[model samples]
Target: MAKNTGKAYEEFVRTIQQSLITAEGMSHLKNIEVETNKKLTDRNGIERQFDVYWEFDLGGYVYKTVIECKDYASSITVEKIDAFIGKTADIPGLRLIYATKTGYQSGASIKAEQHKIDLLIVREADEREWTAEDGTPLIKTIQLNIVALTSPRITSFAPNVDTDWLEKQKDLNADIINHAFTSSLNNEIFISNESTGHKFSLFDLSHLLLKKIPDIQYGKGTFSEELDNSYLETKAGDIKIKIKGYKLDYEYHAPITTSSVIDYSKDLLGIVEKYNTGTKQMIFKDGKIK
Candidate 1:
């Protein structure tokens, strides 16, 4: 017999709630509320508990969205969608969302479409490494895909405003590079121009260069001085970078790939060299870093 776990479905609900809360457009909404297993009274004086509830203020109006999570081995049936629709009718201006781990039946999809309910199929990413028949090791990684069966029809009630985060996607590559550099070095890197000096992290330099020259492509490889040499190249110019290991006190030795070469590289070498004391050594002990 299979073991009975009371909280077996709690993690699934939490992951869905978190994904919605952190989504590109959803996070910036004001007065956002996300809850799970919330009990409330309906219009007909009937009490009901929701699996997940989300509400937010947009354009001076509060919008409510309720989610029902089903973690079953079989697909959700039309009967379940009909029951959900009946409950949604009691709550005014409530958007009903149904999420299932095993997807929905064909009739269930039709029912959701008729009621304008949003259906989401949530699946966790599967990652594994195995040897093939030829003795070659292979790896596979699959990401979670939150597919919407029907689009929410409640947008007409609120103004169609584009999120600032979505607008930044055009410059996403540059933004990612900047964020990585600045965050990695804690905003200590600096760059000087013809007249003025500006400070940026490794990511900042990359972003700035990319912006100045649109054709440049940023690439990275495994840290190796002899075999692998990583560099940033553009139509204007190219710079060679070395992957040097810097040993911090009692910490893991971080690889500093870029040195002071141009306007961005000044003072970076000194800062990185300060941590390269070579006193702290990493010894492989029992297949672990020590």
Candidate 2:
């Protein structure tokens, strides 16, 4: 497939863009107009322009989406992403999209795992041709859209009492065990011993810890358990685990891949390092670090 130069990709993106325009009109877009070098003022009162911006009208509301086209069949940089988001942040109801001739970056999938933001790669594939029994070309246009779109929602962490309490230990990095532990012992409790005290205010801790775990369960094996928010992210590593609450009143566990192929160990450490010392030791083995 790589030898073919990814013709399948180019076809997909072209089709997707066309479909988006034809099916969904932009603000003031009577007909699908692909505009390049489109400029818009930013919140800082600075004028900024995009490589490609789509404007259409939808349901009496004008809508605009910003798109950046890339050639390298890889992912984008965080720095580049920060700039893009910054540009459109002020545009009310504005959607951001990316177009690339190559595939996505390794990090792109991670960012896109939820509401599928932060990654958009366009790879072209070879056009398929079909012939009749007589070997004559079939009269057909196969314009398919293969791009995926995610909702525009922020992924929150699952509630962890220990993580929440350890987050308060402060001034040092802490490692949060990916497991879910909920006890009716107390709505707000502190589980740490003297010299290192950890406080878990059910409300504050739940909300805070939930930002990292993304999924959690509260209750016993026999009773109705309360689940928390959902996280839309790709597993980057195995060392990190996530639990989240979902709509159907269920608690789900998301295990970060432990396989060596994934590089999430560092990322998880970075995330957990912002917490307490007591929790930090639990994550690091023999001070050699994972």
Candidate 3:
């Protein structure tokens, strides 16, 4: 798994390099090399190869841009960034760029600015600015819809936030699920759109929905036949969807892993009865509104 992952990472890094140097011709950069295998000895005598390198003419001065791409489950810390910067100090006129899948942690931007280095942080999908329910403006990183049992495909757009690791994970999960699903189903997919709305076989929807909402439970019997007679049941935190023409249209809502504000309000009385008079068992915080 690690080998395959490394191969994919190398490929992705190369693709980006090609896009910048060959396709985009970014500035005065030339001869972008991906994993040229030019090994350097770290300050601790540990050897590491540069992930990418290119020559750029900055104000008629030829400078080398050395990049280190990191894909890790955790965010890059100041120590790691410092190490990468230290790794290139031996080479003269070295401009450093660090690209990470998980992004850098706090103080990274300050360190980069202090060192006059370019830091590129990439994540799965960029964030978008949106107003909250209370009209508070904020930005949220877009979460990709990764079907657990389907192959993931990424549609790229200019990211509002870094999402390198998220994107990688989504793509990897998608690839595995898609291959299995395609193989299991023999790749025979059909689509239909009628005036009554789109219609798909219960078998297909069942599989798709199962991947999408694995926690949801469907009642006994097939869904294709139950669509026409069912009405949705949304009480008890259960979503009972009844499709008029297909029995398979009855997909129970996914389990509630998290509760909403309304859920607490609706069940407040029950909670109060269950825990309010508990003889100091339920301790409220200083600022809490009991």
Candidate 4:
């Protein structure tokens, strides 16, 4: 099980490594090779295996980078960073990166900075403002329908007309109305009109519906409205429906931002140390590191 887990993690690291390289515009580096579980012999003839290894050339100089993947539940310690630094000393010009799922300990970050090694934390991207095709901030919208029944209860709420629009409604009604329920107030029923493509979840739809149509049980008859961009219609028969149109929801992948490089020919260590100290001071004052 441990072996299988390690292989799975190696594959994941390889995939992310390739993506990061390409996304960061490092693909121009010649002889760009990314490998998993690559073995190398040290000066003392001791074999060391790396989780993910990469090498490339830039400006006529070839550089090697060794990435260590730690799929640990807890944060990585400074001891691990020290061991990795020792390995780097054995192999000259070996740029080191420590990737951890749970991030690094406080000392680990300082140690990594001292060694001029990169520390990367793997996790889900946080929710942020995202724009759509027309530069409008993408939003999730939900439309729901609440029906008032007089005598008979609605067992099913299928689309009435056989038009193309109504045919689409038939399938949508099946998807949403399956969760419909009959209330005790004069056999009145509440059915939501849920259609995909809006990226809204069912809980979000329900919350929006309650806010928009607060008095669902007071209405006597059916009503319909045609707004500028949306429509709300109602039909009465064996099953009454007060619902709105729906569209399919789509998933969007955000583009990665480019990273700035620190030139090693300059005072790289001094710059890194100053930056780290400034970051910690900022965190102490503003309650955030970045």
Name the lDDT value of residue 233 in candidate 3: 25
lDDT, each prediction:
0.48, 0.41, 0.45, 0.52
Instruction: Name the weakest run of 10 consecutive residues (lDDT summed) in model 4.
Output: 264-273
Residue 198 error, candidate 1, Å = 39
lDDT of 1 by residue, 85-197 (tens): 88778888888878765667889888888887877755442211134557775443333444332211111111111244335546435455445343433234322221233
- Candidate 3, residues 17-39, lDDT tens digits: the string is 54445434454354445453457
Among these predicted structures, which one has the highest TM-score?
A: 4
TM-score of 3: 0.36
lDDT of 3 at 106: 67
Stretches of model 2 off by over 4 angstroms after superposition:
1-16, 23-29, 112-119, 127-290
Per residue, candidate 4 scores C-alpha lDDT tens digits across 177-290 of 443323222123323333421333223433343344454443232222221222222222244333343322212223334444432222111110122333211111111222
TM-score for all models, in order of appearance: 0.42, 0.34, 0.36, 0.43
- TM-score winner between 1 and 3, please give it: 1
Q: Considering summed lDDT, which 10 consecutive residues are worst modelled in model 1?
A: 267-276
- The lDDT of model 4 is 0.52
- Give one digit per residue, the lDDT tens place, for model 2 in 1-290: 35644344434444445544443434234776666667888767888877666666757997776666555544465555555666666756767776554444445534434323434443322212234457787543433444442211212223332345345644324332322223222232222222333333333333443444454444211112233332211122222222232211223334333322322232221111111121211121112222
The total number of steric clashes, by the backbone 3 Å criterion, in model 4 comes to 5
The candidate maximizing lDDT is 4
